[model samples]
Target: METVIITGGTGLVGTALTNQLLERGYKVIILTRQPEKGTNKAVSYARWDIEQQTLDISALQQADYIVHLAGANVGDKRWTTARKQEIIDSRTKSSELIFKALQTNPNKVKKVISASATGYYGITKDHPFTETDPPADDYLGTTSVAWEKSIAQVISLDKKLVIFRTGMVLSKDGGALKEFYKPLRFGFATILGSGDQYISWIHIQDLVRLYFNAIVNDRLEGIYNAVAPNPVTHKELVLAMAHAAKGRSYVTSYVPAFALKLALGEMSIEVLKSVNASSRKIQDTGFQFSYPTVQEAMEQLFK
Candidate 1:
């Protein structure tokens, strides 16, 4: 059986992808920071301390593909200077560690697929960002660029490389939806800022499916925006979820821009930034989204 090594194999995306791969009869190896807690016999685990920059070389040797999902959650904490450094290192440094393992060890690994973000385009008010556009000169863009560049070692080693610039992923379990759902469960929706900033979102199912496609479809290389083509303004997304909830006394209101700025400080730029990314490149590969629109995505999540 072909083995796939995934870094950060316990995060939201990693956990879901692990099940999908195992169900398909693929050997899934998780490169984790806490190997002692890994109990699933169906999958294997290798311990790696990113902070210490160490890895189990066998994890690199036994893989046909590498899915690099290891990254700090940018929204989990306020974007202090230290937190910013952690976000960049979690991605780039982990990538460097994987590359180092491959350098020192004899391995037959063929492909390296890494996670990236739509933040590569910076905070644009209008124009939808495409893969062909140049990187934005901002913190998010710089970090994403560095993260992507760190994987150059894979391509340099003559392996297939795929990098996906993902947008906000909507999952019923957790992530952006969880944050949005809490307020909605109380019969109200809190829209951020002017609430007109475009939100490029994809269902968690679609996002994971895209990763599957990247592994199986050799043609999908370089960078592709992993977002639903039907990007909506923030207000539209909030109301759509409220409608989907089918709950009593549903009310949608804007949380003033000043309040969000005050509360989030530097991190507020993420929520208030407009992101309109296109998924045309991925779709051209004959890929179809299970949830192409927010209403469809929300309906399924609520169901």
Candidate 2:
């Protein structure tokens, strides 16, 4: 079995991906700030601190692959200048640390799979974005550009690199769906802006499977959008969540952009922005999505 090193092993996606990798018989190693906190019998933990720029290079010395998922939570706070810097630095610095570690060590690590986001496309209101689309010029776009570029340094070391531009992941435990549904538990779900903005989402299971696929499938390289085939409008997404939660089908009220801006600051734009991403590139590689539609994905999540 191949040994794989994964950063961000404590996150929602990381936790799910670690279990899946372990179940598939891969020797999983997790990089964490606190090694003692990671108690997975199937996973070996190593210490890494992004702020201090320290890593256990010995962990990568024999790993077959590295999955870079370490980053500060984007939606965790309002996007103040300081908070925005934290987001950008957390992503780029972590990727730089990983790349440098890999380069300094004469390791057998052959491939590196890093995390990006559909936020790379910025606030697109019209066209559905593909991996081939040029990155946007906004804050999220610039951050993703720098984040992805930081990983490109690993490619220079002759490591085959794959970047997963992820979408809003839907899971029963956590993620945007949980945040979206939490408000609905109070008997009302408010749609931001016009509610016509498209939301591209995927099941957590599908995303984990996609990461695993990137590990084994040598043909998978470059940037691939990790999203479902069918995208939903904000209105449809709220209704689907309500349907999933067995809530009454009430009218979806709009939260005006001005209010969202005042409330969430710069983060409000992310909440209100329209982004429809295409996952055809990854699906073309013979990888099947378990939840291709929002309705189906939400149903599975709610179940």
TM-score of every model versus the real structure: 0.97, 0.96
What's the lDDT for residue 9 in model 1? 86
lDDT, candidate 1, residue 248? 50
The digit string of per-residue lDDT tens for model 2 on 23-74 reads 8899989999999887787789999989888988788886999999989989
For model 2 the local lDDT of residue 55 reads 86
> What C-alpha lDDT values do all the predictions have?
0.89, 0.88
The TM-score of candidate 2 is 0.96
Candidate of highest TM-score: 1
Q: Report the C-alpha lDDT of model 1 over 1-303, residue by residue, as the tens digit.
A: 899999878989999999999988899999988887997888999989888989888677889999999999999999999999999999999999888887778999888999999999976655788899888887898999999999877788788899999999898787887898898877888898999899999999999999999888878788899999899999999888888885456877789888998999988887898989989988898999989999999999888
Off by over 4 Å in 1: none
Could you tell me how far off, in angstroms, the CA of residue 30 lies in candidate 2 after the best superposition? 0.9
Our model 1 lands, by Cα RMSD against the true structure, at 1.2
lDDT of 1 at 205: 90
